[model samples]
Target: MLALLSLPDVALAQQKARTVDDLAKMYDVASCKQCHAKVYEEWEKSTHARSLIGTGRTIGGFQGMIRAGLMGAFTKSGVKDVGDVKVEHLAQCFKCHLPQISDATDEVARELVKAYLDADRATLGKVNVNCLVCHNTKAILHKWQDGEPEKGVVYGSKDGPHPDKYPAMKNSVVMKEAAMCGQCHGTGPNFEFPQPSQCATAYGSYLHAYIPAGGTETCQDCHMKKDGKGHLMPAYRDPDMAKRAVDVDVEARGYKFLLKAGDSIPTAVVTVKITNKAGHRIPDG
Candidate 1:
């Protein structure tokens, strides 16, 4: 016998379509499109889009791994006859390469490959660094689910969509901080691998050079702003940003050359320290 399930059935049937906000609440970046149209547009053109899409880089890295027998070692029956070992490592590759979908690890790689084949070859190359790579970021930690806001991210437009329902756009501190960049830029246990895993040293350079020196510069300050950084996040992508980051700051003072020290001229102490002030527990590789 079937009892009447009126209100509960109606309620269940009437569930509304999930908004980007709803998706964001569940850590799905598919929702970021609600307000980040400009940044997304730029990212679509840049290599940022290819962060997850299949690339020779992935093949090359994996092939190198295969040659090293990392995949072959953990197989069930035989070495050459090995099954896919640590396919999870592909996900790790996407942690930075396809950050938006990284949180949606449930089905990122297949979706990426599908998306890539559907689009132009040129489009596929620029997939990893996507639209919200830097702007929507609160911090640059490895885990998508755990980025902390070093400061709150502020927005310029009043009507722009945000996690907060209000239209006010002040106290958006997250956008101007170094920690936001450190999520992906820093080194740690997760990155201490034989292969290049962490960008911590790069992030460290930015922090120490700019933050401690009383330079109100963030990663974006030098790489993005100094030369029209634009949304592409060209610091790592474009040669221009690399050249721009390279600059000579001449701070000259007369050396005392103290003989009384009785040391090897103190080794010409040129102390340079880089910081990853951005907060995120990077993997302990």
Candidate 2:
């Protein structure tokens, strides 16, 4: 047996968080506010911050996914109810919503499901896609090329010695790439699971439709750079961001015309044109 002291940092770090509280402590976001006050404030208002507890919709979605899908006859997931849920079962939804759930135990998965099912806001709010999630856990898209995310190292735009809990900070090769956001923003259908899910497909449209149609801007170029909202990463939900994403033109005209050199005829014409100026398809998940 491998002694605890001799275990590799990755294995030791992810010794399997025992509960929702334990997972929350593993990737605590509150501590980051000390060093990143402004960015943290922006993130506080983002969908990522409220991933599992968003306007009652996200939690409601999970309740349905669990009751109607995971526990339903269609999936054959080998579960009769939420009580039987495990980490693999929740991965369908939590893969992006609360990715840190992966490090947690099956009991934690069951607990989270019940919490969401009952709309227990306090407990559901315990975890989110926070600093450690983006700048660390999910920073590297290709583990083979960039190596697995280190336990204590934080990935960012610059390489240096971070001041607080995270002792190291290294620049990630894909941090600024659209693929970074694509990791969660997703392509069509996540085939990683047995029953495929079509949760998010914005990245797919961005590549196939937006880029193919002479669009050059990237996801970050617009969301983080042009919008300049930083961690907020506003999308269709924000009125201003939604308005700016598309351009609409309406034209109406009424006129009278002589029909076959006989009686005068009245005519009306109207035209509506909508141009999608954003980097991807409008109304994409």
Candidate 3:
């Protein structure tokens, strides 16, 4: 006799036919974890992973900052109370903090923001930073188009299996360019600051100094590859990495008499020098 087996709910869900747009909307860091387990695990410990909640080094993350900004904007705009502040006004905050939601319509984004305002933790958690913001090679294309992604295109630095299913699986050189990071890290209007200012000017600084000085290395070379750890781009988080970027020295001159021999004290001159070995200026961005 033959035995019949039933598919699990998750298996059934995965088996359901989905358009590329639906897949893009459904995919998250957890989905990526199904295949790239090691990369997912490493990213789980990274600053990018905590970018939404502001854990680890990000203390009081983007959510807190956005709320503060909304409160201030409402106060300045003569809105009577925090409850009166419209969610639509605050939706732009998702661009960097929650790129997936940001790509959705303003109406959809407003609903998510409203959920957060209503103290719905589950809805807020859904908006946390995800994988595709960086890894998606067609991020630029998707970003500018303002609609569902092309039907069967999947962009990345490498080609994946099932090219017949995903026709846009083309290798992209932009993934390896410093400008790729500049999409977020480069100069941009400062949302947190009250006064107008450009935030995250690392790309501009690198171009102004590093490129002009005949430096050919990309940001990934120093931050990602220097330690042989792929995704953990250590900056201030690693003391050794920070130290490698610059050298410090101290020198003291001999004491000199400043007054009459019996009545005066001598003073010594101390000098401290810091030499930046990195191509760009120290404390970039």
Candidate 4:
């Protein structure tokens, strides 16, 4: 079955017998404030809180797809009426972007994009690919939840800490695995990444002979960093996380004050180039 529970919510889900509806009920972003109130405050200021959900950053990538006439009729339902669709309809985007909300079918996804296009400041701007999309394990792409394996993600402690609200995660090996990042970072048509896009190929570098042998640094180690961002997976283009991962160097390049015809010859050509020396991949799924 398509995975419904995000990792954080999975921790809570263990305490109770969870159904799809139960998962939906418990996956409230508002509920995160119960324990992570301060982190929630930081998250509120961060772009992560608003990203795919149409709040902090522009969801123009997905939106641009629609404007470019990439949208087509759903093969399953044979529904082509784009005029009647709403912004809350896109399940494809919701599947990876908004894990909590249900009924995000292909038709619905089209509707959501359409709705976003037609929406004004009013209507609360239906939650587009909201907070749980990337951070929550539920939104991981091209993977299915294995029922037999102890389901859920745990950030702190091994053998799992007992949570009164939901499920308790026991083994955290999943957190350290590159597969964890591949859960969303890489994409395929259904299970493996089918397309040739950069988003789909993100996990390849981790699997190859380059980088480091047996590198255990998962995406979470760099982006999540146990810094209370939950699962926003911030990196690269991120305005905030980039600052924490960058350093600058300056050295004198044959500087000599020479007065040539009263023209200041004290300055020489100084070149500066920024490189992504530190930091790593972030899961976009």
Candidate 5:
């Protein structure tokens, strides 16, 4: 009992000593890319890479879109001054869109946003999704201490090299589950949209229907396959991928014993069957 009780105290002390930069180093994709060159190269071309920053029609992509939507919501709520819109109010958007920023508390987000507003474009634009955001197996273990991530632990799906150098390295099975992807994909009500909306309904639909129907495949199995290469989650974005997700068949039957010549024309019954071959409902999200 004494040993168990002391554990929390020890953890608290360690957490208090760490800074935001310490946690950032542990989660930095740049550091990770040194060893994971192949994975980094693949991810570089993926939509995930441009989640926070992009160009052309994809400028800032989803992150920019969410920010614009939130700004609109804030405007509607009487926050006429753009400067008055607090980063805390946009926490929900950061949760998934800016996971690195969201990993820390709202105060940290506020500080970062302030720095961003004050700094040059080249400096502020460095913010984006990092490795630990989605790949962290022990995501539940992540917590905030003094407006930064709790120190001494970094999680992933598989064991990594240099565990001795980086004591925070650890593996977890949860990273392999559909629930991991559902963290953002199965989002609920937030500041912008308070009502329950059809966001990423794949996981919910899978639970209620697919699981009971004896389905075992996870979101990764299909979305992270050949065309995606575990990074690009191509759905409607890729024409061929969308077509491959569902199987369709048409059957027709004609009545042999029809009515008289002038009577009602012989009718043919056509049946069209559509099967979801991707483990979730078609057109998810």
Candidate 6:
């Protein structure tokens, strides 16, 4: 499934994070679990919760991209060895995998790629899209218009004082819209890096085909708000959504076939057709 934050266009920040632990200090979801336990538990089951170590495939892909794209001489990324890798080198994959990497030093990038290459799940899984990623860091779409996301503020549907570390809560303008998910759900190749790479095009498909075809549901409508999905935000991984997104039909005919020996042989022809009923492409990759 494409990450809900597959298009986290996090602005570069002054480097502070040097290790996964450092990042956890700012983005850990566990901290919010105290008050938002239900939502936090649901998020724990989501792909966003394990944005970097998703099913172990994310780690393998990161390892492969480093080997083939950075060191393979194909992209000329100026990274010929593992030690040569920097945050900039991993920008293509980290754009979606973990945009918070932008807040870390190059050393963190080197450590991450090495962890991926070494298949270190514990290390790779340490940092991920946490509560702040949505409710704080990425909550506002128009930063200039809405002002920057305040440090102690947790953006949600309505404004109020939070009970936890986040002292304040402000209503987010784009929280219910598709843009919140579509922002990281991918539009096209990430052209911001020297070596551009695309993770998912569902958002582009949603904008072009789904919207033009008069499809009214937003991504949040189907993924977040529907069927009590909440923070789970399932896609194809949810069996019900999979069944609803695709349909298959089968037909078969039995007939007699002519043989060269002037004898008739029984023959069977089977035809199968599959259709997509979802807003975006099925099995988006």
- Residue 32, candidate 5: Cα error in Å is 1.4
Model 2 over residues 194-263: C-alpha lDDT tens digits? 8787878899899888888888888888887766898888888887788889999999999989877778
lDDT of 3 by residue, 51-131 (tens): 544444233443354466555543563334344544345444444555554344434444544555565444454444545
lDDT of 1 by residue, 20-60 (tens): 22223433344456677766566555545554433445445
Evaluation by lDDT, superior candidate among 5 and 6: 6
Each model's TM-score?
0.48, 0.87, 0.66, 0.55, 0.62, 0.89
Off by over 4 Å in 2: 1-14, 252-271
Model 2 weakest lDDT span, ten residues long: 4-13
What local lDDT score does residue 81 receive in model 5, on the 0 to 100 scale? Answer: 34
Off by over 4 Å in 3: 1-27, 55-69, 73-93, 104-127, 141-154, 162-168, 188-196, 253-268
RMSD to native for every prediction? 12.1, 4.9, 10.1, 9.0, 9.5, 7.0
- The TM-score measured for candidate 6 stands at 0.89
Best by TM-score: 6
lDDT of candidate 6 over 210-255, digit per residue (tens): 9999999988888877788888988887887888788989999999
**What is candidate 3's TM-score against the reference?**
0.66
Score each candidate by Cα lDDT.
0.44, 0.85, 0.57, 0.47, 0.56, 0.81
Candidate 5 residues 1-285, lDDT tens each?
354548876665455313345445545667667777777787777666654443344344333333555445544533333344444554555565566653454344444444434433343345555566664422553334313332445566555554433456556555678786777766334436432233556777777778889988877776776565666566656777767777889999997554777566667899999887766676764
The clash number for model 3 is 0
Clashing residue pairs in candidate 5, if any? none
219: Cα error in model 2, Å: 1.0
Cand. 1 TM to true fold = 0.48
Off by over 4 Å in 1: 1-38, 53-59, 66-70, 73-87, 100-129, 132-172, 188-200, 208-210, 213-215, 236-239, 247-285
Model 6 whole-model lDDT (C-alpha atoms): 0.81
